[model samples]
Target: MTCGYARAVERARAGSARVPLTRASAALRRWSQRSQVTLTAVLLLVAGLLTVGIAADPDWVPPATFLLLEVVAVFLLRLRPLAVLGGTVLVCAWGLWWWGAESITPGFLAVLTLSVVAIGVFARERQRLGLRGAPGDRMLVDLRDRLAAHGRVPPLPAGWRVDSEIRSAHAEGFSGDFMVAGTRAGGTTLEIVLVDVSGKGMGAGVRSLQLSGAFGGLLGALPREEFLGAANGYLLAQAWAEGFATAIHVVVDLRTGDFTVSSAGHPPAMQLHAGSGRMELLDTVGAPALGVVADLRCAALTGRLDQGDVLLLYTDGLIEARGGDLEQGIDRLMGAADRVLAPGRGSAAAVLAGVRAGDDDDRAVVLIQRA
Candidate 1:
C-alpha cells in the first residue's frame, strides 16, 4: 500500500508539470499565429544585423551598423517602410559587395534561411487573414485612431450641449479638419475650437494633427483672449514651409452664459436669437490664419447667450460649395438653421447635415445652446 501511494503521488506531480507545459505551448502557438507581422519585422531586422556583422571588417565600424540600426528603427519605431527602404537597399548592396563569392558564416546563413521561412509564413498568413494594403496602412489606421481620440469632444457642463461632425475628403486615413470641446477644471467655463488646416490629403492631415495637439493643450488653459495668440505663436515657431490654418475659438461661462469668441481667418460663427427667431452672423474681425505672419493679433468678441439662444460655429468647408461662394453658403446655412433649430428640436449635426455642401473639402461644425 505504501509503494502504491508513492507511485500515485509521483504520477500526480508529473501530470501537473505537463499541464503547465501544455498551457505554455498553446500560448506560444497563439502568439505565433497572431504576431506574423511582428515576427517578420524582427526576422528581417535580425537578418540584416547578421549580414552586417559578417560582412563588415571586425576592426572597422561598418556603415552597415547604422543601416542595421535603421532597420531596427523602422521595425520598432513604426516608421514608414517606403520612406526608409532606400537605406536598407544600400546596406544590402554593401553586404553583397563585401561578401561576394565568400562563404557566409553558418549562423548568418541560418538566420537568412529563417528569414526566408518567416517571409513565406507571413505571406501565407497575411493572405489567409485577407490583410489589406501594406504595413504602412496598418500604421496609418493606428495614427487615425490616435488623432480621433485626441480630437474627441470632452464632457461639457450641465445645461449646455455641444455636437460636431467631420467628414474627410478621403475615404480612409485622417482628415484635415478637427474640433475640440471641453469644460475647464473649475467647471464654470467651457471652450470649443474648430480648425481646418490648409490643403488636403495626408500632408494636411499630419499638420492638422500637429495643430490639434497644440490647440488641445491650449484650450481652457489660457485666458480667453490669449489662447489664439498662443496658438499663433506656436504655429510661427513651427515655421511650416507653406501651410496655414484657420480656426474659431469660443469660451463660455457656464453660469452666466457670457461668452467670448475669436477667429483666425475662419468663417464667421452664427447666433440664433431665441426670441426674434433670427440668425445673426458673429463675424468678428481678427488676424490672418496661423503661420501667416509673426506676432499676429486676434480680436475676441464678447456676448451673452440668453436662455434658449443657440450658437453655431463652422469651418469654411460648410459654406464653400462648387458653384456657390461664401455669401451663398452662409445664406444656405442660416436658412437651414432657421428651419431645423427649434427649441429642443435639432442638433448641430442635424443642422450640418441639412446644409451639406457639394464640394469635397472637409467640414466641421459645432452647435452650442444654453438651457
Candidate 2:
C-alpha cells in the first residue's frame, strides 16, 4: 500500500512536469509562426517594390547588378527591417534619379505606393519587436504605453476591480476597442470608458488615441452628461479637419449603483446581469459621430448595476466582423458574455475575452461591478 501511494505521487509529479513542456512547445511554435510571417511579408513587399521600380525605369540599372542587389537585400531583410527599408529607399531613389528627365510612370507610382505601405506595416511590426521607427511611430509608442497599463489601474471606489487587455491580431489596423477605469472623486463614482474608433490602420489608430485622451480628461472633470457633450465636441473638432470617429463612453457611479453613457456613431453597449444569462443593450441616444458637427448634444443614457452585472462597451468591428454577419458576431459576443460574466468568473478579463473573440477590427470592452 505504501509503495502504491508513492507511485501515485510520482505519476502526478511526472504529469505536472509534462504540462510545462507542452506549454513551452506551444510557445515555441507560435514564435516560429511569427518569424515565418515576418519573413514572408518582407519578401513580398520587396518583390512588389522591385517589380514596380523596374517597370518605372527600364534603364535604371544593369540587370545583373539590380538582380544581385535584390537577392542580397532579401537575404538581409530576413533579419533586419531597417536594412529592408533602407534598401527600398535607395533603390527607389536610384531609379528616380536615373529617370529624372522622364515623367513618373504608372509603374513608378505603384512602386512608391508599395514602398510606403510596406514601410508603415513593417515599421509598426519592427517597433513592436524593438527594431526601428517611422513616421507616426511616436503615436504608436504612446498607444503601446497606455495599453500596457490595462487592468493595472487602481480599484474602483466601490471596491470593484478593473479588468482589461490590449492585443493586436496578426494584422494591420487599430482594433479600435480600448477600456479605461478608475475611482472618481475619492471613490464616490467609478468612471469607465470603452471606446471604438472608426477606420483602421494609422488613421483609425490616431483617432482612437484622440478619443481616449478626450475621455480621460473629461472623466475627472464633468458629470456624465457634460462628459458626453464634451466627447461630441471633441469629435466635431476632429471631424472638421479629417472625417469622423464613432465612439461610446460611459461613467458608472458606484455610490448610486447607476451608470451614464454617451455614444457617438458607436455601437450600443450591453449589460449582462450578475447572476442570470439576461442581457440588455444600453441606450446609445447620443449625437452623430464626433468631428461631423459642432455643439452636438450627446444624450445620456442611464442604468443600474447589481453585483455580478457586467457593462460591455464595444466597437462595430465586433458586430460587423468580416468573417461573419453582424447578427452572428453579436450573438457570438453575447454568448461569450453569458459564459464569462457568469458567477465566479466576474472580472474585466472575462468580458474582454468575449469581445476580443468577435473582433475582425479594432475591439475593446470594459467591466465594472459594485463592491
Candidate 3:
C-alpha cells in the first residue's frame, strides 16, 4: 500500500512537470516563428564569419563586410527582405569575381539560400497578418483628408472679415465643434453656421463631421429662417437616441448690413456695438436642441451691423466649465473681447486664447466684423 501511494505521488509530480514542459515548448515555438527572419540573418552572418576565418587568404575581408552590411539592413535598418536579398546577391557576385570562388564556402552558399527562403516566408506571413499592406490605414487617411478639406472656412464676401478658432478637448486633429461660412445668392448674402455637437473626442467629432456636411448643404440652399428647422428635422430623422446639437446660424446682407440670427439651444452671441462700445447679447429666441423635439420652431432676431461692429459666435464650451459658474465665464469672455477688440488690435485667435475657460471641452469661436 505504501509503495502504491508513493507511485501515485510520483506520477502526479511527473504530470505537473510535463505540463510546464509543454508550455515552455509552446512559448519557444512562438518565439522562433516570430524571429525566423532575424535568425536567418544571424545565421548568414555567422556563416560568412566562419568562411572568412577558414580561408587561407590574408585579404579575405569581403565576406565579413557583406555580412556586416546585411546585419545592419536586416536587424537595425529594417529594410525589406526582398530588397536586401537583391543587394546581397549583387555583393556576393562581386565578391566571387574579385576574390575568386575559393573565398566563398559551401556553408555560406547554403545559409544564403536558406536566408532567401526564410525572407520569402516572412513576407508571406506578414501579408497574412495584415502588417505588410495598409488598406485600412489608407482608407482612414482618405477619410481624414476629405474631412480636413471640408472643415476649412468658406470664402467670405467683401466688406466682411471673418476669423475663427477651435480647440478640442482631446487635442486631436479634429474637434466636435465646426463652422461653415459661404456666400449665397450671387454673393449678396453671407450664411454662416457654427455648431457644437453633444459629447467630446472622436465620437462627437464624427457626429460633427456628418452634421457639417448636412448643414453646409442646408445653408447653401435653404432660406435663412428655414435653416435651423431643416437641420433639426434632419437630426431627428437619424433617430439618434442620446444625441443633440446646439447651433447658431447667421445670414448677413452685405449691401445693407442687415443680419438675421437664429439659435437652437445654443449660447447667445455677443455683438460689439461699434457706436456704443458696449457688448450685448443678441436676444434671439431659441428652440429645443436638434433631435430633442419633433415640432421645433426657431425664431430669428433681426439686427443691423454698422461699419466696424463685431459679432462673436461661439460654442457653449466657451461658457461651461467644470466646478465653475457659466455667468462668470460669459463675463470673462465679454471682458476679453472688450480688451482684445478695443481698437481691433487683436484677432479672434488672440481673444480665444485670452478668455479660454481652461477645461476639457471642445471650444469654437467665430468673429465676424463689418469692414
Quick one: best TM-score, which candidate?
A: 1
Q: Model 2: how large is the Cα RMSD against the reference?
A: 16.5
lDDT of 1 by residue, 1-371 (tens): 25643443344234222312234444544554566567556645755765566466534544334444443433332223322333454446445656672433445545544443444454445444433224433545555665676556666666777777777774445688887666785777888888888887677777776666667666665667767776776777677875688888888888899999989998988988888888899987567998787777888888988888899998887789776678998999999888888655778678878896754778777788887
Query: CA lDDT of 8 in candidate 3?
Result: 36
For lDDT, the strongest prediction is 3
Model 1 per-residue lDDT at 337: 85
Off by over 4 Å in 1: 1-135
Q: Which 10 successive residues of model 3 have the least lDDT summed?
A: 12-21
Give the lowest summed-lDDT range of ten residues in model 1. Answer: 12-21
lDDT of 2 by residue, 1-371 (tens): 25643443344234222312234444544554366557546665765565465556557642233344444443334335545544565555456547662544556556655655565565556556433322123335545555434324565554565555554443553545566555667777766666655566655554555455555555555555655555655565443445576666666667667887778777777787766669887767457876677766777788887776767766665567566886787778777777777664655556656566643455555555554
What is the clash count of model 2? 11
Decoy 1 TM-score against native: 0.64
Give the runs in model 3 whose Cα sits over 4 Å from its true position: 1-138
Between prediction 2 and prediction 3, the one with superior TM-score is 3
Query: How many residue pairs collide in each prediction?
Result: 0, 11, 0
